[model samples]
Target: MKLLIIEDEKDLSDSIRQYLALEQYTCEVAYEFESALDKICLNEYACIILDITLPNGSGLEILKELKRQGKEDGVLIVSARNSPDDKIVGLNLGADDYLSKPFHLPELGARVAAIIRRKSFSGQNQIVIDHLTLDIRDKTLKNNEEAVPLTRKEYELLLYFVSNKNRVVTKEAIVTHLWGDDVDMADNYDFIYSHIKNLRRKLAEAGCPEYIKAVYGMGYKFSIPS
Candidate 1:
């Protein structure tokens, strides 16, 4: 999953990114308001960790923009403001959860996971699609009763596909989702093609039907065979 951390504190943002990266999440950061707004408008994330106070804007305004745009990305407010009113207002503005600052990273992680589960997967830890079962917490996949070994990137790619199943996802989108800002270092999308090829071969060897389809010039789609 991808996460956006809208925080002015560089140390905190780096810590959050490192911790979440261990959980196999692609993390991006916006240190101020305008960049945060631009990122929110341009891309979608599984969850956003937002601080109520920002460099030039209120995180509440970001919440308002999300609601105004009808974007359903899960949001978790992580701020030093622990007052009941702040919590109430954030929730009312469509935040999925709120975590007061000076919190344990584990708790924040759990809260983020919970919000993503509720918003994206209907609060389910295991997503069952046809013959495949994805254990979200363990980051494992099973084909029927057998376990399918997957690299971290492969698992993330598969989860991405499953989350946007049946929708055409462009290679650019895939690159961004997988590599985030670091994608600028790449010259081509051959890495994406390699990952997709490996994922297809792994799934097929695990006795799964072809779920990923090339859409020619468009991109790729993950749809079960009818």
Candidate 2:
């Protein structure tokens, strides 16, 4: 999933970004309010980690703007403020969860996962498509009674495709989502083909029907024929 971290504290922001990145999440950061607003306007994020206090503007304004635009992205308010009023105001303004400063990074990660689950998966722990079953908490994929082994990238690619099943996903979008901003300067997207090919082969070998389809020169789509 893609995440936006709107934090003015450089150290804390960096820590969160790095930790989340290790968990296979694409994360971007804005140290100030304007940059954060620009990113929100430019990209679609699964969630936004917002700090109530900003140097130039309040994070509450950003939350309001997101709501005004009908953006469904999850918002988690992270602030040093610990007052009950602050929590109430944030939740009322559409924040999914609140995290105080000095919180554990793992706890923040768990909260983000919970919010995404609530938003995208209807609070379910497993996602089922055809004969394939994906365990979200354990990060495992099963076909029938057996486990299917997938590399980290392969697993992430599968989840991405399933989450956006039946929609054509551009190679650029997949690369950016998997590799983050560092993929911008890549020479070609051949690596994407390689990963997709491997994932397809693996799934097929495990007795799963081929669900990934190439859209000519466009992109790829995941679908199970009805």
Candidate 3:
């Protein structure tokens, strides 16, 4: 999963990033309001950790803009302010959850995981999609009762496809999600094609049906046959 931390407190943001990175999540930061807004406009994240206070502006404006733009990224508001009015306003504005300052990092990570689970995996840890079973916590994939060995890229690719099943996902989006904010540093799209091909081959060998569909001029979709 990819998370954007919109926090002005450099120390707190750094700690959150370091902690979450160990859990296999790509973390990005925007310490100020404008940078936060720019990141929101540019990329899609599994979750956004937003702070109510910013040096230049209020973070509630960021929530409003996300709602106005109709982006459905799960938001977890974290701030030093403990005002009930702020919590009420943020929740009313569509923030998924809120945490006060000096919160435990483990608890924060759990909240982020829960939000991602609801948004991406239908509120379930083990994703049972037709013939495949993926345990999000264990990061394991099984075809029927047999284990399927997949490279890290291939596994992430499968998760991406399954999460957005039936929706066309562009190659560019895939690169961004898998490689995080430094996608511009990626050389080419060949790696994506290679990962997809390898994932498909492994699934086929494991006796799973082909669920990925190419969209001709568009991108690719993961959908069970109707």
Order of quality (lDDT) = 1, 3, 2
Considering every candidate listed, which one attains the maximal lDDT?
Answer: 1
For each candidate, give its TM-score against the true structure. 0.97, 0.92, 0.94
- Checking candidate 1 for backbone clashes, the offending pairs are none
- The TM-score between candidate 2 and the true structure equals 0.92
Residue ranges of candidate 1 with Cα displaced over 4 Å: none
lDDT digits (tens) for residues 120-151 of candidate 2: 77888899877878987788899876899998
Worst 10 residues of 3 by lDDT: 178-187
Q: Candidate 3 lDDT, tens digit per residue, 102-166?
A: 89999999999999999888899998877889988777899887889987777778888988888
Please identify which of the two predictions, 1 or 2, would achieve the higher TM-score against the true structure. Answer: 1
Q: What's the CA error at residue 191 for candidate 2, in Å? A: 1.5
Best by TM-score: 1
When 1 and 3 are scored with TM-score, the better candidate is 1
Give the whole-model CA lDDT for all candidates, comma-separated. 0.93, 0.88, 0.89
Instruction: Between candidates 2 and 3, name the one with more favorable lDDT.
Output: 3
lDDT score of residue 15 within candidate 1: 98
Alpha-carbon deviation at 104 in model 2, angstroms: 1.8
Higher-lDDT candidate of 1 and 3: 1
